[model samples]
Target: MEIDSKDGIERKLNMAQQSDFNDPVISEHNIYVCHVPVNSAFYRVIFPTSKINPYTNKWLKARFKKAVRMLEMRLPQDADSASFDAKKAKYIASQQQSTSKTSFVMDRLLAYEDIFIGQSHSFDAAFEYAISNIYLCPMMGSFEMRHLQAGLQNLQCDEAIHADTDSEFTESESETDDDPSPLRVRFVRPENEFQKKRREESVTLRNKVAEHSSWISLDLEKSTMKSASAKLNSLFSLPNPVDSLLKLRDAEHLVEETIVGNKLAELNLEDRHSLISFKEVRRLPDALQLKALFIKVGVISMQHIEELISFKIEHNLLISRIREYAHLVRGVWVIKSELAFPEDEYSLQRIVRDFALCLLNANLPVRRSDMQLAFGLTVEDFDFSLTTFGEHITSGERTWRLRIDGDETFGKTKEDLRVLIEEKRYWNRRWEEIHHYLSTIKNKSDFTVQKTFKRSFSY
Candidate 1:
């Protein structure tokens, strides 16, 4: 076959087309071979259109025309079998070496065609042309190729079955769309005996707390309240003992006042003053104490001091332990200082900013009142100072926290503050536990003494 000439190429193509059905290869498997010269232009035209279809004795066609167009673009004039084999080996090795299951499955699926369309007219050229394109799978051994094809067929069958089931379900859902009633399933676990009892006790405790708010302090521990309520219920055999406890508390208060009065009369002036100071400080609430401290030291505005110290007192409640020369404002005592305020507005603003930052860095929320007390700033001056450093802080409901975004310094400081706060909380919890244990022990000791005294009297 002189394939160099156009006439000879045409003759070769015609022979391939005429023997398409009669040839053993074409009859059995629709395999058509069209021999063409290496440099012939007719090779491209003959290769794609000359192949016979297996099911129908017609021209073979590509399922994806886009893929065929791309393949045409990549087709090389001269094929290199060595280069093609090397590339194929590399591809197979990559598929085998893949660690990801998804990639391996995809690679296997790509290794063979689902439908057999016989061999390509130019195997080396086709392989070389599509080697770099990942969408195209390289040819594999006959046995592996056959296995992949079978697997693909099974997969297709499963998918078709699943698609039919889905269609049926969708149709049923459309039918139900018109119905007003909806079906719902709720999964619940029935409570056991212990859970039921616990739930009932919780309800009872809540009811008692709601009914008798005056009998017990709201700040009392939940466990302590529970135990006290249980004891009261068991001892008196009453559903509610709050009224009895309230009357007992009033009587105890009277007796305590009488004893304190007698002790005050017996003590000397210095000791009496000390006793009175201790009692006054103990009686003062935390909010009142903070106000007294601010007022006495003149940390707040002078205008606000008089209004803050509303409580009438005959003498100052001096706490010498807090400060040696603490000021006495009305009845409240606070730290005395001859400290000078900064004359410059900039300096005063700087002080407020520094203090606020320190609080934020410690993971403590900044309150306006605390800032005013710390810096001796009036409402106007405090607001002005806050406005000056507004970008660094974010406001909460009644407090402020550091805004760490975009600022490296604040970000690192916040992280460190978080760790410090966590450690402090851990220690605080430990201290609370120890205090609770000591309180329990003291209570047990007092009960034992009372029991012993009663037994002695009975004997």
Candidate 2:
């Protein structure tokens, strides 16, 4: 299908007509394809519509390239064909309601947690970590378990002490029934059993440290403890107790790291697959099924949102960014077009930079071609201009590099001009001046008088 260059968006083909195979006649613009009745297309592709700002056409082009790359990668769980099919089916059937490729991928990952979460490949290191770490005491190892048991015992002791104190107070009140003054209460606090146990463990750990002198001391004859009770032997070893402890600690840490690392690797693999799957992704049923799973699991993070939207800048945000670019382009055009013919190249370059980069924060660097495209300028518009914005010396035969002394033509340096432009009050007064001048000219008949007044005003 043809699109008129004049208006880029106008469809030249009849929408009712279809190709011989009954496929929709896909209309191609500069870098995007728009299928008629987009929702039912093989894959829903976002195209630049009349509603989208012209300045954002570049962004759409970039998104199209990213989406294509996403369509090329393979899924992570390619081997488990049966399981994959079953999971997909269950996801589809269970949805009365629910959403997106990203959501589907995340749900599958959650369901198959064993692939990413359970076992550590580095068993020796992880086991060593578990045995030695003080923090892992509550969860594992003989010494740490003993410490936890002691803590519980301490809690029980505190409750018993409170009960005894209450009983004594009751007895004393009964013996002196008529005494109105509150009975002086002084009960000795017991030594904390948890602290005592901790101190004992600390002393033992310190004593073990003394035996080793260094943390890296390993038993050279590893064959001595090669039994099912190897772990028990490590716990009771007198010399270099810390070595055994550190190994246990390392094992525990390794387990945790392995779980997290494996999960991340699988997730990354799946995410890559999701990108590829985007090409054939069917909406409605599949999206709804995934959404349902996400809702069921209450997975409502920004990452989930990003996954759903394919991490492209959202429409509103894109429009906002584009609007800033367009405004800068418009402001520059307005300022330049009103100036006298044969303005200095340095001044134009400075003004364009100040308008486009400093104020707008353009996503891409401002270039001559971009500036031309932004305003749809023709060769005639630049007839009197020396360069796209200003003159710059050509580097070798290939590149245009601005010379150090390129701005010698201007009264002020680029930095000085930028500072002046950045002042809010300066722009406000300029805006008011322009407003007053524009307010005076109601029709073409007033232009002659207005031009005279404007020349005198010297803006």
Candidate 3:
């Protein structure tokens, strides 16, 4: 096979002639880059695969040669095949586990198996792993819990596999179709207590989600016409709005296929990349539509939020400040309305009572940005130094009182946020001031100022 390196191309070289290649092309035009780690005794050579002995035979032995010059060769002349395979295996094992949980795995579990079965087995496993490995592991009390029904189903599958294997090896039974071969073996139901409990839990949970889901649907449809205009602006939009929507609608069906090769190449997920790139990924309809739906889904269910609840929200804007995080709530339902209520949101009972009032006033289908208006906040009117807005969190409750200095323990939340939505009033501002000084820049564009910001979402 011909070879190429970062240095230059080398033609028709056998494995030994080329000692090492930072990059090499092997038999069938596969190309690889080898990296020799700093402060290490050995190095790795990578190359394209060969049809006949693509990655096989003498090609690998050449990889074993320690010296730099000999390592560059395409093939090694004297090495035995067995030794190369063993070393190659050793080398490969040193690599971090790169085997992906395949789309096949997700497909086999979700599509091939029963719906609940996949969620119970693979879905839960992946979810648990993500929580434990990525998030919750350090906490002392954290423990992984399994759904009892899922556990039982898995236990049953294992037993079935064993029974089938044993029946095949049976000496006495000779299968004959005429008499139906004695039909079958006795079935033993799973006896595990956890399994029984999980099964019952699964049925209960399914019913709950189904009931809630139905309620959500009915509510959203009722509100759709009223709120449809605001929601659709974000949903049906196209960079080239006329053509992009049709392309996006087709994308919903190909989620799995579209995400495969293009995942990390995705600029939006990595914040270090320019925000312009973030806008580009949003052009993908699956992500944009999903986000649009999710935001609306919560709007439809706002009544479900209890007045004294605090919801950690999405739509956070990250500016330069080290610890400051900003969240924008598009719409929230107010439980009650009053001509005049307490000026602050600090009191537990008061914030819920007041915020609920605002929700009631917002009418159906509040613009997410409009939710800020429900609070009746102004930077000039409110004192922000003391409480900053924490008192406004309903904690676990939905209604929160924005804290004023009088109830100084709680802080100005919606009040502080008012600065964001108020149309920029400083007439004296320079072009550079808008460009750099506005740390939380969302609503500006050279051609047409982007009126709003959208978060790319995936569930």
lDDT of 2 by residue, 1-459 (tens): 454343345666655464555656564333222112211212211222323232222111111111111111111232244333333333323431323345655655433211111111121211223233321111111111000111112222245544554554445335544444687755487558897799899989865655454222112222334652564344333334566466565554444443423233333211212221221121223323233222222112223333543235754453233222122221221112212222354344333333333222222333446445533345444322323233333354322221111222221545434433443344455445544543553444468878989999996
Tell me each candidate's TM-score: 0.15, 0.14, 0.16
Where is the poorest 10-residue window by lDDT in model 1?
A: 140-149
Which is the better candidate, 1 or 2, if ranked by lDDT? 1
Could you give me the TM-score of model 3 versus the true structure? 0.16
Best by TM-score: 3
Q: lDDT for model 3, on a 0 to 1 scale?
A: 0.30
* lDDT over C-alpha atoms for residue 441 of model 1: 62
Whole-model lDDT, candidate 1? 0.38
| Clash tally, candidates in order | 0, 24, 42
List pairs with backbone clashes in candidate 1.
Answer: none
User: How accurate locally is residue 68 in candidate 3, as Cα lDDT from 0 to 100?
Assistant: 12
lDDT (C-alpha) at residue 182 in model 2? 82
